[model samples]
Target chain A: MAGVDMDMQILIVDDYKTMLRIIRNLLKQLGFNNVDEATDGAQALQKLRDKPYQLVISDWNMEPMSGLQLLKEVRTDTKLKDLPFVMITAESKSENVVAAKQAGVTNYIVKPFNAATLKNKLQAVLGAF
Target chain B: MTDQAETNGHEQRLEALVSRYKDIDPDDLVNIVEGIINTAQGDLSSVNLKVYGEIEALSRYIHSARQEIASLRPDEITDEHIPAAGEELEAIVGATEQATNSIMESVEAIEKEAETLPPEVAQRLTDSVTQVYEACGFQDITGQRITKVIHCLTHIEEKVNALLETFGEPGERSARERKANETSGAADAELMNGPQSSEDAISQDDIDALLASFD
Candidate 1:
């Protein structure tokens, strides 16, 4: 965790306000303070287009567009491509995971996950962050 | 008289006797007819001919509804219960979400102040706060489950209403029920539905394995 920028701008997206708050709080606990929020995939997509974020953490079951769709969009966009994208959702189905992986996800965390799991996942994805 | 003339006269008198009871012994004839109707049709004599069509319609409606809801017990499950159940589940989601927000706010405050604490104490506080974060996830899971229930209740209400429409004069839905149907969002994508409880559903570990190849 030593050399990880604590001020790295992270975007957390979910339709559920409680979840967005929970994930943002956990990220804050991990020492990442510059976090932004979007309630759904469409808004998250618009935000990504407008800003430069180091990472995007999104939920999978949002309306109009899902996290997988956002991941695909990010991968396809020349500017947003190569960004570290993690999916945190209650959609723990295997097919959902496979779809996310195929669409190019940096990491996928299931719901009801603790801070330790989140930390390890983030560390693995962001290289010890 | 001719044989044909005699036959015609007999037919005319018989028709008069059948069609016009008012002409001969009106009270006596009424009593006889009422007795016959009671024995054969169970009080049909009291029913006005003008409303016979409405009575027949009602009878048909009851017949169809009975077939549709043979097990339906109106006394046990009144018309209001299904919608009420859906509303209650929605309220549960709202309450849990409010509670979670309050908890998260407190945790955030604690986390901020933990920065100044000594490493050992701050580490313990962080651990406790981490547990709280994980516990708060209960709201998300339970919210999904409750949403599914509300969908089911909405479905049952629709079906029951469809049947009940048969028992009464059909009319356009009231504004409140119309608003409810339009707002339910029942047509959303079902493949990425809320957490599944069926045997066919996969688990977190299975999801992890699917993503393991990426690592």
Candidate 2:
């Protein structure tokens, strides 16, 4: 079943427009053609309701709905619960990590991360095909 | 395709580094890249959380209002209720706008900082930062290269704040506010494309080589 699954559909949510474009392009570069974006958690939720996304790559902090809140929302909703969520942030503090884990973040990546690191984390969370 | 081209380009850059700094350790370059990336990512995360908090507050308010609205009986539908609902919706939207602005501000700060780093490093950092930002949902930063600039500003803010503290900074509070204001305008613009693309995700071999050469 996993083998038959095509490129993963990823939802990249951030409040910055440039960041969204960068993620979309990055995913495309990675051979993942199915990518969508939401500027914040609310919009991201709307998109999630509108479609099926295999993975959600989100920023930890945002307006109206932070990544943690979104993660919690996704987890609490029966339909969206258990969705794979990777929280990307700039904070590397242990507390932040613990908080995210507690909130059910599948993985966390600190900002300014290189492509290599991002790929490794993704592999860890999404698993290698 | 674009990411592929970007990766190749990055490879060429790594090769250039190997040839250009024979006396330097490749790891040094890698370290530098890592430092920049880590710091930038940290800044991005803070921005995300700050905006997220604001949104959550607003969302909660909306939820409360929604509950109240639901509790009202059919006969309770009054002209007064209509205005209140509109006001609540306006507040929610306002909160969203505020959160968006905060995120944008952080992006701008990151971009500004990216501009200060070494060219290749700056570009890579810029790309990665932007990619994360966009994957999160911003539509405006699509083709922009402002992540570097924003990162640069954050660095400046840190330096400035540190310096002030070292000298027993008196205007510490205002200094932070001033720094925040400095990047507000940068956030006003829309986004550009994510980093060069997944095709650009550097391979371990290439990364090792670059690090080795830089070491």
Candidate 3:
């Protein structure tokens, strides 16, 4: 809130409803009140194409489409390519990190993460909010 | 009645038939002796026919048994049962998600209320609430684990359904499974397996180091 635009439009995508709520609540706690939600990559992609979002926080495993796929699509799009995207998922394999990095992820947050860890990941991309 | 093959293979059987019955009406001969007396052969033909019938019946029974075991639910297991198991796991995921949301809702209310309390009490309450938020993460991890299980169940269902097709009539499940197998939408998606336990998987520190390398 002090150093960042607390009103910046952010989109959080995950297939799990609870995870969505958790992320929304966490983002709210961090003073980023303007947030959107998508349940999977296809819906998230559609949302991204339709509007401008400051950041994308997505889970890696989802039906029909995964976060990595969504990131790849975003990176390839001229309009959305530079949008900051962070992947927050239970996937912690080394290759998963490598793949997300290759696809232009802003940061990776493994699952079972606490508020501190989430804040750190966010601050890294969003500039120390 | 027709001249036998008289081939070297069946010659012995043909000789017995010819000598015993000759021109006799086999039916009449059987009636005189007993019902199965080959009726026609008046000798081993009835016994041979009975043995052949028994063997045929046994073969049919064995095939039916194989169908029962392999098909599991016989008619519906392939189409329904395995999917049902996977559905049950999905339901569990749903139930856990519901419970997790309920708990988070309460935590949200608590966090909201913390603002009204005395500063020290509010800060303590907020800290405890943050812990609750962290604890809520179990829902995500467990949900992922359950999803992996559901995937496994679906895989097994596919395999079982394939075996079912071999033993029984091919049906809708088989066709659907074949279609799914043929579709390679994400050829290497399998390599990006979901998270492993902390001990088995890379840590945040490791990821940070990797990200630095990319930078």
Question: Mind giving the per-residue lDDT tens digits that candidate 2 earns over B1-215?
Answer: 57789889987998798899788777787789878878764455556879988999988987776555446532122224333544555465455545665775676577778879899998887777655554444333221223334444445545544544444433233212323234322321111112333453443344334323432
Better model by DockQ: candidate 2 vs candidate 3? 3
Check candidate 1 and list the clashing pairs. none
Tens digits of per-residue lDDT for model 2 on A1-129?
Answer: 254244778899877555565566556545577888888888899899889889999975565666777888899989899789987654344445556677777877655555556667777676653
lDDT of 3 by residue, B88-168 (tens): 888987887788888898999999999999999998998888788788888888877876776676677667666666666
- In order, the Cα lDDT scores of the candidates are 0.77, 0.61, 0.80
Please report the candidate that would top TM-score against the real structure: 3
* Regions more than 4 Å wrong, model 1: A2-4, B1-79, B164-171, B174-188, B198-201
Which scores better on TM-score, 1 or 2? Answer: 1
Q: How well is candidate 3 docked (DockQ)?
A: 0.57
Q: Which of candidates 1 and 3 is the stronger one according to DockQ?
A: 3
- Looking at candidate 3, what is the lDDT of residue A12? 96
Writing each residue's lDDT as its tens digit, candidate 3 over A1-129 gives: 567888899999998778888888878877888999999888999999999899999998876677888899999999999999999988888888888898899999888788899899898888877
Q: lDDT-based ranking, best first? A: 3, 1, 2
Candidate 2: misplaced stretches above 4 Å?
Answer: A1-4, B1-215
In model 1, the number of clashes is: 0
| Per-residue accuracy of model 1 over A37-81 as CA lDDT, tens digit each | 998788999999998899899987775677777888999999999
